[model samples]
Target: MPTGPKHQRFVFVEHNEEGQACGYEEDCRCMIGEDHDADASDESLNVNDAADIWLSKGMDEDYMFGFSEAQLRRAAGLS
Candidate 1:
């Protein structure tokens, strides 16, 4: 029942022109510089079920999943 490498998850907040969150301040708190809450019931899910979740400010379509480093490199066109 080995799960292999563990993937890290992050949450990105959308800010307004003045660098303020649009809405849901309580639910959508900042994830940076803080340890992820393990007891938290609600959590964000990665796009397309990607192993390594990356919260970005803008649109990103490069997220992918692979079982190994070589597979990830190949998927990202780094091979």
Candidate 2:
């Protein structure tokens, strides 16, 4: 798992203009060059079982891709 504040936060997105999230760094680079709106959050975190649950609920369904809590848990193999 990532250590410290710098590595703790992570960005998760379902898709960008190109479709399904490829990577954050590349997306940020392309978008920044175009001067398009880009967002970041201190809320992103390195994955752990509990964090996975929180992430599912936190994803923005209307503005971004997000998985339901149950879906995240199942994907994490949590029974």
The local distance difference test score of model 2 is 0.40
- TM-score of candidate 2 versus the correct structure, residues matched by position: 0.23
Question: How many clashes show up in model 1?
Answer: 0
Q: Candidate 2 lDDT, tens digit per residue, 1-79? A: 3322222223544333222343353323331344332464646423343335465667434422254444444445664
Q: What residue runs in model 1 are displaced by over 4 Å at the alpha carbon?
A: 1-66
- Where does candidate 2 stray beyond 4 Å? 1-37, 46-65, 68-71
C-alpha lDDT (0 to 100) for residue 49 of candidate 2: 38
Cα lDDT, model 1, residue 4: 29
lDDT per residue, candidate 1, 1-79, as tens digits?
3332334445444433332323332332334324456665574432222323322312234443223344333333455
Instruction: Report the Cα lDDT for residue 14, model 1.
Output: 40
Which window of ten consecutive residues has the lowest lDDT sum in model 1? 50-59
TM match of model 1 to true structure: 0.20
